[model samples]
Target: MSVDVYLGLSAIDSRRAVPRATKCHVHLAAKPFVVVGYHLPGDPGAPIGLLCGTRRERPSTIVVGEPREAKLRLARLANFAMDLNGYAAQFMQTPTTSRRALHTHRPANGPQLVVANQATAQWLCDVMGRRLRYLRPDGDRPVHPGLPVAGAHLSFFAGQRVPGSSLVLPLTEILAQHWVTGQLPSLDANLASQLAWITDPGAVAEAEDALPAGPVPDPEWETREFSDAIKAYHQLVDAHPTRADQPMTGTIHDALRPSWDACWQALDLLHSLPPADRARDRWTQDVYQWSRHAERVRSGQAYFRKRPKQLQVFRYLTRLERLTADLSREMALDDPLIMAGHVAAGEALSGEVVTLDLSGRRPSLQVRPHLPFPRPVGTDLFWHLPRSTSPSGPAWPIVRLTTIGVTPEGLITLDVTAGAVRRDRHDRLPQPGQQVVFSPFGPRDYHPDTLPAELPWTHAEDDDE
Candidate 1:
């Protein structure tokens, strides 16, 4: 009995604006028709399916039961193949055509190619090898008619093709083993380039270990460092060269590139900063003199002259103040002025009877008089009382210290209310029901006694006072 396979390509869904097309290749014999959704049927007609190029529209189905069914299936297959070939030609000619055009044209008596059964498909593969090409309707092009289409039944051939044994291996395990053992040449040069950009040495090592040993070209780690590595990583992501959307190497590169660049920038910034105060002092002095001169002009009688120039001077002063503030904060120093070389000028007045030495290092006294008191080593905790609740209603000194504590465990305990007090030890932490005041560093126990019942200082009743 002669057996014929009828292949029809059609879209998977009917509702899409353009349906997604797939190819169903069905085999038929003279007897009853049988279709196998999972396994290849033993009977006359069994559909060994292979999806053709993806389409934006639904594809027509092929029926292969009786003579009429076979003729109809053959005709549909022939039309589909011819339409696919024509679509491929059009796509090659004008690449920018709308996806709707993918299935717009139908061919007359579409071409038919005959194969006996699944074995014939494999035999054809062996005979044609890489030379085999199929008219892919959905892709709108010709593609290698290998396992993706021909012998797609290999996935179904699992248990039936193998000799009867008590144990049955899964198709995935068999394919994985074949992939590991198979001597396929290294990936194409373009693919290799993509791997180089996206795959790290560590990931490459893992992939290599999973597969059978092969010639792994050295990963040029040295040459790829610094700027080149960043550029290559970005290129890999942009091109998306992998057949699989979520290739392991692509994932590794995506994660590593940004983190590596950030580390590089951080290192560069650290290297830019001075290692010692001596180096910092030189930069500070130049900045300080520029700032002071600008400040003097703004405060003096010359402030009103050259208003535009004064604005510029004020801007410069603002920048200098910010720089000085940043340096002081970073260095954890009381005063940045000590590094501004102001101390050196005071030494020259040593011989004078009324010599004034401004050499002593001190915290900025702009807001208060310099008091001869021991400096505190910890944070000066304070709070900004909301204006509405304050005695004077919206006034200064609304800022006041709510509590004081040692530097190390400053907020181990707090008295938040007029009479209530809460205590916390390293071992005995406060629970949810207990009111707690949270510090920027972490949570703290709120002591009710510490909190003032109301504003401590009352506002004067009259505005004249």
Candidate 2:
């Protein structure tokens, strides 16, 4: 945690309330396509209901009148699948030439899928992918072509929920990242509690306002109100098979509506903050990835894998670690508040230049700051030059730490080695009174280098048996 976050938490404790950050630090391409619903608790493979849409008022809600019928449940799911697929299809339908690669085709943009929490996203992807991926349109019990297509698309998005992509977002996770609540992280997982802490502290004190956002409802509510509603709907279906199942849909809608509204409200909060510079860059990469998956689907090669091969698993883990570090550095460089944490942790430091020895054989300088300094001499650092000429231009100039000592007035002195600057580029160099920030990340790219086009025989396991 940064000193700012520490100080903010202390203030929150004193005031008994959490506060918003100065700006949003997350990248959001557009209003999120929000999804809120519950699945059968005991039957993991069966979904009880789902309410989802791009807009809050226009969401389509589906509840199974008979959850026991596997085909019936899957048919209802197929409807939702088609709807989600249709929404996502807009991004995949059109192809444009890649700006970075002349001969390659890329999508204009990608769809963003938002869920109540991380578990809901994982559940939606894993369970639905298994149920629908292999369904055949020409088989005896034929399924719609859209069902498998949707399954592949949804599975692709769920996999995209890893560190760098903004395609699949969890509302609670994003909110907690930008704000620290007075309560524990466990409590923050509850959307209602987190929103209460953020918008109205008094709401947390009342039971009525803090409703559960769930794939599982509260046992008390489930045992009484929700149970009664389901029973009544079944009774109506039994008495008049022609009548609609409004009662079941209504109850599930009421249960999910608060979180539905909360997801949009949280979007507004996250939207207020300016996006990090690399956020859009990462999203563009997501578009490229999505387009590739869509191409596989179009080519009749989109079979969802239940388990990745050993080589693929190794590659995935390695990529996840690298992406996590890349995201951290991006977030820190984008927001000063986030960088402050690194400063507190001694991973970075910020100060004003004190002395410049530009005439020396190896040009160097000294810096003085009021903050604590813990690094030994000879450590390397990068300075974020404030006079960056373009929005996409490189801002960090690399420098090495050379010396550390206390002066007569008890002030810390940091000496740094640097290369000679061009006379015309004097404006880019840090002058003695200018405040500067330094950290480990600089102009170097951390993205994994592209591997060879051909797969090695070692990675292709034998299936001769």
For each of the candidates, the C-alpha root-mean-square deviation to the true structure, in angstroms, is: 34.1, 3.7
lDDT of 1 at 15: 12
lDDT of 1 at 251: 30
Number of the top-ranking candidate, with lDDT as the measure? 2
TM-scores for all predictions: 0.15, 0.88
Candidate 1 lDDT, 201-275, residue by residue in tens = 234334332311111212343233322433444455456634222332233333233322322222232233334
Each model's backbone clash number: 22, 2
The list of candidate 1 runs beyond 4 A from truth reads 1-51, 56-60, 65-70, 90-465
Clashing pairs in 2: 2-341, 24-273
